[model samples]
Target: MALPTGPATSWLQRTGFPSQLFETGDNDYELYEAEDEFVLSVEMPGFEPDEMNVSWSDGVLNIVAEHEDEQRDRRETYHRRFRFPKDVAEDEITAKYTNGILEVRLPVMRGATVSGTEIEIQG
Candidate 1:
């Protein structure tokens, strides 16, 4: 697809996805871990609830949204994936979309811990 133009640009061209988010220097998608759950909020506008899909598989969260402008013959698509550091209760995971923001909550399983080794800088 052709890149967005300077003038007459639509919201689809602004923050339609992770691609345009960096240009604005704002946290379009925010992710943080609370005491018991991981929360993530993504900025996505101009899309109806039915036009989006949120799913979880293999410790990863996937978000996909699309908008089609039939009159203009244009299609907009957004896809993003997030991998968790700790084990999550996949069955209890939930998500919601409101006012253009998609928020997902992943409950961390009890006694589940992150497995990783920290690396030290070598001189």
Candidate 2:
């Protein structure tokens, strides 16, 4: 028996199972900076838009989703958190789900910088 290339994905996405339950640790996403905002795209299929929830607090972005099939007595759950480097405009953050992809836009505040100490290299 042989496995497929690339990251392993789950097939029980519809029956209360998230995609890629075994591989990637369910944190598969594409993140990049666009102008003054950060864009994130995550692949999530077999769930309705109403089942997804997105929120931000402090410096972390949280995404939680769940689907319950009462007749079958099954449930699917997905949860992931992300932290930003620079300060983000909490009120301006927006998210959308289309074609099984979750896209989130986090606007960066004007002239926001991270407060941390610089690390020195060892010689």
Candidate 3:
């Protein structure tokens, strides 16, 4: 059996940005693919829905959020980082925050197909 070659793997290798950032931390994401839609659930804490920004572009999803210190008597800094997927639609992504967790829901287009090439066999 031969191996499958795709751009997704090539893109990851060429990017060369430590993949550790993308998979580090207790924060996790779950993707559910169904016949009708795709659901993405990301666990984001300490941020309100309004404080976060979600956008999709060029088949990539981007999420940005800032956390401000509530106490005037102390100063705090964000030392954590995250790596987002590279093939999400930023314009169609939707997010909502509740109970210290941010939930993002993205609907996959009905007829959308994964970007790749099909191999034909010759007898």
With a 3 Å backbone cut-off (N, CA, C), the pairs that clash in candidate 1 are none
Position 21, candidate 1: lDDT: 26
Model 2 steric clash pairs: 10-20, 16-75, 16-76
Q: Per-residue lDDT of 1-123 in model 1, one digit per residue for the tens?
A: 865434335564454332332233256699999999999999988778899999999888988888887675566667788899899999999988999998899999999998689889999
Q: Which model, 2 or 3, shows the larger lDDT?
A: 2
Candidates ranked by lDDT: 2, 1, 3
lDDT of 3 by residue, 1-123 (tens): 633333235455455422233324454666676554456666666666666676665555566655554453222122332233334444566667667665666666655667668789999
Stretches of candidate 1 off by over 4 Å are 1-26, 118-123
Scanning candidate 3 in windows of ten residues, the lowest lDDT window is: 73-82
What C-alpha lDDT, on a 0 to 100 scale, does residue 109 get in candidate 2? 98
Q: Give one digit per residue, the lDDT tens place, for model 2 in 21-120.
A: 3334445788999889999998888778999899999899998888776776566577888899999999999898999899999999999887678899
What is each predicted model's overall lDDT from 0 to 1? Answer: 0.80, 0.80, 0.53
Highest TM-score against the true fold, candidate = 2
Query: Which residue pairs clash within candidate 3?
Result: 55-90, 56-89, 56-90, 56-91, 57-90, 59-87, 59-88, 60-88
- Give the total clashing residue pairs for model 2: 3
